[model samples]
Structure formats: C-alpha cells, structure tokens
Target: MSSSFERYQKRRLISSYFSVVLSIALVLFLLGLLGLLVLNAKKVSDHFKEQVVLTIYLKDTAKEVEVKQMEKSLAMADYVKSIEYVSKEQAAESMKAENGEDFMEFLGFNPLLNSIDVHIKADYVTEEQLKLIADETTSKSFVDEVRYDNDLVTLMNNNVKKISFWILVISGLFTVIAVLLINSSIRLSVYSKRFTIKTMQMVGATKKFIRRPFVWKSVRLGIIGAVVALIGMAVVLYYIDKTFPELEFLKNQILIASLFLGVFAMGIVITWISTFIATQRFLNLKTDQLYY
Candidate 1:
C-alpha cells in the first residue's frame, strides 16, 4: 500500500508539472504572436504610405533634356522611392484603354500633359513633407502643376497614427499580462512543494541550496515552454505566408530572429524570477504556515 501511494503521488506531481508547463507555453505563444504584430506594424504602415503617389505635370515648353535633368535630380532625392515619366501619348493611351474611347482623337490633339509620377519613400509621406515636396516641385520653371489626392494623404496619416498608438497600448498590456500569468503558474507549482521546502530547511539545508533545484527545474520547464511557443509561431507564420505573402512579415529575417530571441529570453527571465520569488516565499514562511 505504501509503495502504491508513493507511485500515485509521483504521477500526480508529474501531471501537475506538465499542466504548469502547458499553461506557460500557451501564454508565451500569445505574447510571441503579439511580438510579430508589433514588429510588422511599421512595414504595414509604410506599404500604405508608399501607395500615395504624387504626379508632377510638366509645361508644354519643357524640353526633353530638361525633363531628363529633373528626373535625375528627383531620383537623387531621399524622399523619392521611384519616378516614372509618362509621355502625353502614353497618358492618352492609358485613359483611352480605361474609358474604351479615344478622347484625344475627339479633341483633335493631345490635351494630356507630360507628367512624372513620384512614389515618395514611406518616411517622407507625412502631410508637412508632402506639402513641402509639392511646393518645391511646383516652383520648378518647367513644371506646370503638381497633383495628388490631398484628402487621401490626410486620412492615411491620421489612420496610421491611431493604429500605431493602439498597438503600443496593446503591447504594453500584453507584457504585463504575460508576466502575471507566468508568475501565477510558477507560484502554483511551487506551492505544491511548500512542505518539502520546510522539511529541507528543518533538516539544516541552506536556503540557497534548497532553492537551487527548484529554480533550475522551473527554468528548464520555462525553456521547454518557450520552445513549444516558438513552434506554434512557426506554424502560424507558415500558414500566413502561404495565404498573405504581401504582408511581407516573413521577408524581415532580421526582425523575426530578434523576436524569437526576445521570446526565448523573456521565458527564461520571467520563469527564473518567478521561481526564485515563489521559492523564497515558502522558505521564509513559518512551519505552521505550511498547513495554510
């Protein structure tokens, strides 16, 4: 009967340990998912920002050499990602294709002006920077007028600001939640061994020596949990990459590596701290408190 009871206790303890590890893995996996979102937030914002193109129309008097010079200068600017020169004929043809009619033929001459479509870099898409770019481009002697959807730029900027703010808030909240959840899981695991801790102390064991095994054990479990979380993230990324490659989340190899390292480190650090604190609590408790 005694042997059977000991075996049953061992099985229960192992089951409890597994439960703690599994709970920690789920929490860490959620945090890892958030890390991906936070890292990719800027990339997503930049994608939308790059979509706002500025069209700089040139006057009829603008020479081919002058157009080439302007293109070369714009290409060197930090704000410009790319620029495409559209001849009046090309513009007319595109419009005709869209409308399924030749408006230029009806007008008897090409009324379309030659234009340079400027795709500005994401960093320079702010309203102030765009206004400055328009002012500068419009001041050029060969330029006729600058055109873009002003309302779209303003709306996109506002939406980006709001989204960035919310992500920051959500990230902070998740961090706190991750800490609390891991700490709680560690505490429950240590609580089951409260009597063992007291017995060791009563037998002249030093606090450091008694805490060592528990800390190491917990840290090892933490690493296991982190591995599980990373695997889950890998599966999620694979599915997302297959369906939504345009998000480009997988393209940022450096950021993904850093995020994985961070998640692993977070698991180790939080587990070590929580286990140490949890063990210390039991070590300092009164023998009678063990019953409570």
Candidate 2:
C-alpha cells in the first residue's frame, strides 16, 4: 500500500513538471511567431516601395545612341532597381490600347514622348530623395521632363509609418503578456513544492543549498520547453514558406537564427527568475503560516 502511494506521488510530480514545460512551450511559440512577422516587416515594405516608378521623358531631338547610353548608365545606378525604355511609338500604342483612341487619327500626330521608367531602390523612395532624382534627370540636356506620382509616394510612406507604429505597439503588448503567462506558470509549478521547501529549511538547509537543485531543475525544464517552442516555430515557418513562396521569408536566415536564440535564452532566464522568487517566498514563510 505504501509503495503504491509513493508511485502515485512520483507520477503526479512528473505530470506537474510536464505541465509547466508545456505551458512555457506554448507561450514561447506564440511569441516567436510574432517575432517572425516583425522581422519580415521591412522586406514587405520594400517590395511595395520598389513598385513606384519614376518616368523620364527624352527630348524629341535626342539621338538613339545617346538614349541607349543613358539607359545603360541609369540601369547601373545604385538607386535604380530596374529600368525600361519605352519609345514614342510604344507609348502611343499603349495609350491607344488603354482608351481605344487612335492618336494619329484624332490629332494627326502622336504627341507622346519616348520615356524611360525607373524603379528606384527602397531606401531612395522618400519624397526628398525622389525630388532630387527628378531635378537631376530633368537638368540633363537630352531629358525633356521627369515625372512620377508624388501624391502616391507620399501616401505609401505615410501608410507604412502608421502600419509600423501599430505593429510595434502590438508586439510590445504581446511580449508583456508572454512574460506574465510564463511567470504565472512557473510560480504555480513552484507552489506545489512549497511544503518541500519549508521542510528543507526546517532541517537546517541553507537557502543556497536548498535552491541549487530546484534552480538547476528549472534551467533544464526551461531549455526543454524552449526547444519544443523552437520546433513549433520551425513547422510554422515551413508552412509559411511553402504557402507563400513569394514572401521569400526564409532568405533572412541570420534574423531568424537570432530570434531562435533569443527565445531560448528568454525562456531560461524567465524560468530561473520565477522559480527563485517563488521558492524564496515559501522559504521566508513561518511554518505555522504555511497552512494559510
């Protein structure tokens, strides 16, 4: 009968520890998912920013050789992501297709100018930088005008700023929630062993001696829980990669690795701190007060 009771208590203790680790894993996994999105926010923003094109129209007197050289030079520019030259004929045809209007029949001549569309890099998409680019391009002798939708650029940058602000707010709130959840779970796990802690102190065990084993146990559980969370995060990333290949999220391996290491260290640190505090509480309580 005594052996049976001992086995049951042993099983219960093991189950309690398992529950603590599982809770930590779930919380950390959620935190990690949020981190993944935060890390990829810049990439997503850049994709949209690079979509805005700056069109530079050439003077009608410009020679074909000069235009080709200009296109090559623009293509090699650090700020240019891509460049495409549209001849006067191609521009007219595109307009005709869009509105079903023949420029030659309506106006006797095609007034559309030959232009080069330049997609600038993400970092140069700001209003000030764009103005500089347009002014420089227009100052060229062979360039007639440089044009882009300034209003649209302004709208995009403003929207990106708002979105980033909201994301940061959400990430901060979620982090605090994650910490509270992990701390609560660790405290509960320690509460179950409160009597054991008091008994050790009653037996003249020093605080350090009493804490060493439990602290080590907390560290081990923290590591195991973090590993489980990382595995969950890996599965999620794999699914995201397969489902949304265009996002190219996995390309930034360094950031993802840093997130993984950060989560692991956070788990251990939080667990260790929570366990220490919880154990310290029981150690300080008088024996008679423990019943309350």
Best by TM-score: 1
Q: Could you give candidate 1's per-residue lDDT for residues 142-243 as a string of tens digits?
A: 999999888998999899899999999999999999899999999999999999999999999999999999999999999999999999999998898898
Pairs of residues clashing in candidate 1: none
RMSD, every candidate, angstroms? 3.3, 3.6
**Per-residue CA lDDT of candidate 2, range 59-146, in tens?**
9999989899998889889999999989899998898899897868978988989999999999999999999999988888999999
Clashes in predicted model 1: 0
> Where does candidate 2 stray beyond 4 Å?
1-11, 58-62, 87-114, 139-145, 239-248
- Name the weakest run of 10 consecutive residues (lDDT summed) in model 1: 243-252
lDDT of 2: 0.91
Q: Which lDDT value does model 1 have at 36?
A: 92
> Once model 1 is optimally superposed onto the true structure by TM-score, how far is the C-alpha of residue 178 displaced, in angstroms?
0.7
TM-score of each: 0.82, 0.81
Could you tell me which 10 consecutive residues in candidate 2 have the lowest summed lDDT?
185-194
